[model samples]
Target: MSDMPPSQARSRTKVKPMTSKGTGESDTGGVRADVWVWSVRLAKTRSAAATACRAGQVRVNGQRVKPAHTVRAGDEVRLRQGDRERIVVVRHVLRKRVGAPVAVEAYVDNSPPPPPREAVAPAGIRDRGTGRPTKRDRRDMERLRGLAPKPHE
Candidate 1:
């Protein structure tokens, strides 16, 4: 048998619990749907996050939830960002600022497969063979097409 120093043995304590049991505050088990998305670095702003929920762009447990919707551990979360969509399960709740790596610990991924990246026709635009596009229309078209890429000679 190998013998190690006593100090090293003592330092091997149990993992630190997320919350202090004796204290008034217990660990944040789960968080609001919109809030969790913002906390997990999904949506940029809380307002935008809420907007997504209000617009029915978010779903929980296969049901469309509201902006003020509450979520807890084991609940599934589905959200979309541009062309990519994500599905994650709530593992914890947090309200304060945290590093990206640590913040992700609050959830587990159970995402669905992304749909095929077919050429999407953007709104407010006529066909390619239509009349000349307006300045705004030109910019919009450029942005849409730019989402993919042009072929190189």
Candidate 2:
């Protein structure tokens, strides 16, 4: 009984996906922990996020969770990478990976400031022309790294 074309009528009747208020993110229950981490750029890949979860490098609210665990908004996620840890609070849930700029907006980062440059151990550097380290040079390097004991004064 409608005068509109079939395509137009279908479009009009179509319902849009449910989205969270104010945010463009969907509100379909909750997203998986690993997927959320990867979607928000916390981990380079979903597999990496899962690996971190299995390795106990990822924790939710101070408790370790599996990769399939669901992460809801306002949950605190802590991820350990190398010698530093990243702490963030979920603001929005994402089901798919997003760009860096968009991903940054999905979480509230509360990570501690990185250690000063001086606090980190400096790597031994050799001049470009230097063929190889001499035995003495190697000994000095080991001593600097604290791998060799210092001689008694």
> How high is the CA lDDT of each candidate model?
0.73, 0.89
**Model 2, TM vs. native:** 0.80
Writing each residue's lDDT as its tens digit, candidate 2 over 12-47 gives: 886768565544576757888999999999899899
Q: Which stretches of candidate 2 lie above 4 Å from their native place?
A: 1-24
Find the candidate with the highest lDDT and give its number: 2
In terms of TM-score, the best-performing candidate is: 2
- True-structure RMSD, every candidate: 13.0, 4.0
Model 2 worst lDDT run, 10 consecutive residues: 18-27
Task: Give me the overall lDDT of model 2.
Answer: 0.89
lDDT (10s digit) by residue, model 1, range 38-108: 87777888998899999888998988889778877778888977777788887766554456887678778
Q: How many angstroms is residue 106 displaced in model 1 relative to the true structure, after the best TM-score fit? A: 1.1
